[model samples]
Target chain A: MSRESVVGTAEHAAESEWGRLSSRLILVNLAILVAPVVMFLADLAITGDAGLQALITLGSLFVTFLVVSGIGLMRLFTTRYRVTEHSVELHSGLLFRSRRSIPVDRIRSVDLTANPVHRLFGLTTLSIGTGEQSTSASHRLALDGISKADAVELRRRLIEARDARRGYAVPVEDDGPISELDWSWLRYGPLSVWGVGGVLIAGASVYRTLHELKVDPLKWGFVKDLEHRFGSVPLWYGILASVVVLVVLGIAGSTATFIESWSGYRLTREEGGMFRVRRGLLVTRSVSIEQQRLRGVELVEPIPLRWARAAKLNAVASGLGSLDDNRKRRMLTPPVPRAEARRVAAEVLGTDRSLVLRTGLTRHPRAALRRRVNRALMWTVLITAVPVGLGLWLGPGLVRGGLIGGAVLLLVLVAFAVDAYRTLGHGMRGRYLLTSSGTFAHRTVALRQEGIIGWKITRTPFQRRAGLFTLGATTAAGEGVYKVHDVTDAQGIALAEQAVPRLLLPFLERDPRSAARG
Target chain B: MEDVRLRPPRHRVESRAVNWWRLQSLLFAVPLPLTFGILWASIPPTRQIFMWLTLGFLVPGLIYVLVMPPWRYRVHRWEVTDEAVYAASGWLWQQWRVVPLSRVQTVDTLRGPLQQIFKLSGVTVTTASASGAVKIKGIDHAMADDLVAHLTRFTQATPEDAT
Candidate 1:
């Protein structure tokens, strides 16, 4: 598709270095050929087709290299480029003519990169991304020998144009000194919450395997064999053996928690009114979020953390997906000292944390009772198994072990009740609504009254009898799951109405006056 | 600041001719892919089937491309108006797009070996959208310079079209 004449105006005849840049296409092809050669060599060695394979491999490589080099050289000869006030034009091709022009406004982002080869030449590749592409492209423009100063100037011009079009005042100078601020780092490290759960599960598997192997005297096979070798073992003795095993497993759970909390940490802060966070180990990521995008803020206080007065804070933002990936998602504050948590929250929400604080949202009486009962049952069954099994295996040696088992069960029950009571004393207080639930890792999430997106209240047959309804509040930031279970239905609806107004919307739309008032 | 080049409008291809080239190029694309596939196929029977299918897809496309071409080099022409660039083409199903000088994102010139041999160039007008992008083939190289200049000046004018 050769044309008869050139299609650009005389002005486009200005100096263009596209030919020098397109010559690098040879290097690109050289990189592409390495893979096929390695594969061919590996195949020849494995298949023992050395003579024929070597000949074919060399021939293919030679042909491919020659073809690539020829194409690149031809492109270098034909390629031409011109920059107009409104656009940058690139004209290149051999048999087929292809020209591309990109307008300044359409260039979404410009990236400067260097590979080892380019670094050796003190050169950089300029890659421009146009957001208009339906599918994301790896690169839209790859220009070589673009000076750093030129890249910066291009970026500045683009930014200025974009800002002017958007009716936003352009900053006087991007690099001019601004107030120095310390940014908090948010890191999700190597050890995560999932790691702790995995360890506990793995340990349980080991315990289960050992028990099935009749390693414990509580096992039926072990008891029966012992009785056959000696006499009938008492039931009380058998119960004692089980208690020791349960204690070992309980310790494993705590150990898992400690190990998992060792890493994967994050820190967030509000600096210059934009929320910024830093996280990662292998590849650190930093995100700067314009504050107006935040939809809402949440404080999640888990059961274990309640005693320590520790809580995790998360912010929901529109356009960004979730707090887990700050690049595309919202940002979350790192687990900070309990004393400083509210201060950070206040900064992020642009309000005094105390203003949202309400009283008495914590573990209810029923939850407290259930936690105690479960713990007591678990310990009693465990602590009594070993000694009782031993007694049973020994026939008549320990007849009083049954009595000890009953006593131990009572003691465990009492201890569990105390612990449950102490834990239930923990509570959440916030302005809109406070919710607390959980036996193992209880959480209390407080939402603001005006921040709710929608509200629903549902009651099951059992819950109806118990005079309890589950209250759900949806927010714009799409916190999909929020159920204040067993709350008064009327109160839940009332809370929702109040919170919807205060709920976060995207920060971009925030009126400074309204935000300040808020 | 780096000096920006400005081209005159007369040298650029009319948008209609570009559209014609696109339709022609699209029509040309059908047969080549089919031929390439057939040649690449290892099975003879599959290759034959592919060759027949390629012919079937190419015939209608070629006829349509030729019958109502978007561009007729002998007749198609463009003018850079004060506010817009008017380009029109087509023997039938005539179509025209008035590119507001302000909306013109880029003006580019291209030359291939064939173009160099024939002393011709191709011009591409890249708008923000893929569907509306225009490419004019077999144009005089001098025309590209004019079109680029005309478009750039138009884009820089007061963006008074929409507040």
Candidate 2:
């Protein structure tokens, strides 16, 4: 029977209808497995390697493909999903048949993704997230290679069902989008550390791959000529020239990636209290997060972006996925002007003004600065000692190099320490608690005060001597713990009390003698 | 400076927890010296160095077994109130954690073989946040049960989503 006829009959016969995934999923799976084999065969044909061994290898590959495709076909036919009044259920697997039923009210997010191949086939993968902290397989459900339209319909139906269960007011009319891509934001792309880092990583991998194949770049005539040219120039000038070239290439690469990843980026607030992000050039993505799950927003400014007056925004939400996945899925906006980042953050949090961007953050005590400086000095001694000790054992030529490197390192590290101290601050504004820190990548998190579930106070021997402590406000959002480093003991207690008023009062004591009663 | 300190949590653990810790450390400590002693006797060339190693491990392990239990007893404390649970743990590097009753997700009592020998149980109070779990070890078994019951009641009373 046709898929539609089967679904229609099930709907008429039962309270919920079982729907199959797109049959084209089998073709897509086979194509993914076959493409590489075809390329390998083409390469063999070009090299005229039609030996008996080659024929045997090709036969085995064909057999493997058939076995894999058989499994894929069975999976495609067996998988089915159905939505009832109170829950959504999925039944799948061949030898290890399994069933999953998730309550409608527990569903937290519905995300749609399609790579270039899937998009070419008009298919998308839908993942249903319940926001459980456990990473067990049963907690995750993904429908692979469904028709894009069907995926969208399923996502909407699931969300609507959840909203209905929660007794939410009916969804209102769509209000355009909250934010959209601004091409000018691409200017900040080249200012990110990733611009240079990405180039280095890609270049290293390509070189390594060639080396693995016994190809040497140094043996090439053009590379030898370039080396000769560099040899003739002064050492510092040659280094400068190479750095300039690397930067130019890095900028071009980052700008291209920025365009490809965020070409049609749009952030829209959907009808039923969900925020949807749609972006990507070739492999499009649509992520929908329940508005109620968002605990806060964070404004991230790497050193280079901060210097360029730019920043990015991320949502501090629960159930985005594991820590790494949460970080990737939480991106609300790519690098944008600081003002735009703040505006978007404010919009996302539904606040009048972005509290993290506000001024007059409470400065940490001077002891914090002392602690940082002490740590910086200790690191300098440890690092400098390494090279100096090596030089002493090696030769005088290395001694001069060690001295110069140590001098530069000392300057950079001391400056970094001071900047780290300066960036540290914590404050409360309205209903949100704000904590800002980090020097390499400064993050100012505006966490909802009501969302703070616990407090952790840590004191090291050094911190005890300085009368300073680190206070971590624990929540289920973002990194789970946003710490205010090197605050005085009194300040940590005061801030914790102020952030969650009555939780700590019962445990606090003003006098030591009275503390004996606990 | 005096006003800055936290009032230590209310209750000390069962005193026999010290013996449990001491036995646990001794169990770990005996292995190293024994291994080194066997090596020293079996290997001729490395005997001198191995002998020194045996002494090295044995001396410090003995000291740790003697010192750590009582020191940890003084440091580890826990108190539960109507509104929140508070705990202080660790020696040298210390931490105080406070989790509100409204945000508690689960309360579990764990008793290992050694803890059973000492009639001690450990209670773990989990909040919505992964890192916000408060663990109180070395409490009387009966006291741990009462704490778990008390916490469960408070958590159930506030049936809001902790996240």
Give all TM-scores, in the order shown.
0.37, 0.88
What does the interface RMSD come to for each candidate? 25.1, 3.2
Clashing pairs in 2: none
Task: Provide the TM-score of chain A alone for each candidate, in the order shown.
Answer: 0.45, 0.88
Highest-scoring model, DockQ: 2
Regions of candidate 2 where Cα sits further than 4 Å from its true position: A1-16, A38-68, A136-138, A170-173, A195-253, A511-518, B1-4, B26-37, B47-67
Clash count, predicted structure 1:
83
Evaluated at residue A156, the lDDT of candidate 2 is 81
Residue by residue across A1-518, what tens digits does model 1's lDDT show? 33223345445453643334534445655766676567556545554565654565568778978987787677667766544445555666777777676664444444444444444444455555444322234224546543445544554454455445445643333432121112331222211244445556876776664343323334447667766744456666656654554444544544444333322334433322344454433323334443444544556554445555555566544323222222233435444444455666676666666632324434444633544565676677676666767778886556366657658676767665664444332223345455545444544455554333333344454454544445555433324435565544334433443454322111013234444676
What is candidate 2's lDDT per residue for A165-256, written digit by digit as tens?
Answer: 88985565676788899888888878867777788999998777444433456777789999998889999998898799889888988887
Name the lDDT value of residue A275 in candidate 1: 49
- Interface RMSD, prediction 2: 3.2
Superpose all Cα atoms of candidate 2 onto the true structure and report the RMSD in Å to 1 decimal. Answer: 4.6
